[model samples]
Target: MNQLNYEEISTEFKNYFLNNYRNFIDEQIKEVKNSKFLINVSDYTSETIDEPHRIVTNFLKEKNIKNHRITNLYKTFEFEFDFYLLMLTFDERRKMDIELYEEIWRHNQKL
Candidate 1:
């Protein structure tokens, strides 16, 4: 199998995720847009959006990933870590973030 296209494969998978979860993501965006206050540092209050859910949709619209074939693509990964990272529920994904960086950090790591 060709390993040269890992990045390309990953990008397609991500787009596929956004496409699949359009409804949930849009609801998140609308919440952010309609909220009068996101955070009040002085009062330590927050109506902050689940930022991980908002990342792609925040700047880019949902993209229909055409010709995407991910069914067997996951087999190419030797570990479940990356696969789960790609498909984890929002809460679990956030937990991984906090555990990884000791803070509410949204970032990606490729293995």
Candidate 2:
């Protein structure tokens, strides 16, 4: 993708994630303390495939996220991971913040 296109796509993806997560947080009766989610990309032949689940799984493994839900476009052969982080309490939200750094690290790898 061109630089501009890449930036647009990246921003869209980031916003989608953050918005969904915030909505999840808003749904809770208690405050959120920690939460995390992941988005993975993989290529079989120099072309990135849309495997959001894989991204989520890898993110979960890399960051040690335990209480989150994932939504993904499915493929038959690979594993899928949660796309949303919904922690109903402050403690869980705190854990999420700790794990969120993994998202930054993972995104940085693409740069």
Candidate 3:
């Protein structure tokens, strides 16, 4: 039997989440200036928000953004929906962060 490393297992899980998930970001949410990528998801169905949160949370932790906050917005608007928000900061411009972003991209490529 082949033993899978933690990174491999993690990559697998992240891939699964991205592959089988769909989300819509509200343009009304202001962009973060000089900050890293922000990923937000909303629960408009019976699906749980924990899966995406776990993947995003780990990525944030790896980038040393332990204090990065995740917010849940559940509001009634003639509809029921729950939103999850994550704010991150990069050391440089989004272009410069491409290299690091690629890392996330590559990991996500498995999806």
Candidate 4:
């Protein structure tokens, strides 16, 4: 992508979090103060085959946002090293953050 397109994509990602997931992102920001936190893009099928996730992941890294794209087991294992994980899904209009609290709760019970 060109510089202008990159900027647009970056802006969209920022706006999506600020507008739709502000509260959740705020909580995650607070958690970051006490521990390592990771935001995982759990599904990659929505992105193009040309490594779109890398673009977004690099943008987040520039903003000091810790994140990982869960495309395989190794990546998932690396991401799980963080204390918290926020999974994201792409919908028709925009990306949506999926709360993993219930899944985490259930996993904790198993342990």
Best by TM-score: 1
State residue 109's C-alpha deviation in candidate 4, in Å: 55
lDDT of each: 0.40, 0.37, 0.34, 0.38
Q: For residue 68, what is the lDDT in candidate 3?
A: 26
lDDT tens per residue, model 4, 1-111: 222333454456655534434454345334434433332333222332223344445446655555433334555544430111222323411332233333333444554
Candidate 2 lDDT tens digits, 1-111: 222233343344454545544444343312212224323322211111223334434444654445333333574333222433211223544444434444445554555
State the displacement of the C-alpha of residue 74, model 2, in Å, after optimal TM-score superposition: 30
Query: Please, what is the TM-score per model?
Result: 0.27, 0.25, 0.22, 0.23
TM-score of 4: 0.23
Candidate 3 per-residue lDDT, tens place, 33-63, comes to 2225443222212123344455456654554
Error of 1 at 108 (Å): 25
* After superposition, candidate 4 runs with Cα above 4 Å error: 1-47, 68-89, 93-111
Higher-TM-score candidate of 1 and 3: 1
Worst 10 residues of 1 by lDDT: 102-111
RMSD list, candidates in order: 12.4, 18.1, 17.6, 15.6
Model 1 per-residue lDDT tens digits across residues 1-111: 333354564566466554544544455444434445432232211212344435434323433322223435557645433333355445544443334232112221110
Q: Report the C-alpha displacement of residue 97, candidate 2, in angstroms.
A: 4.8
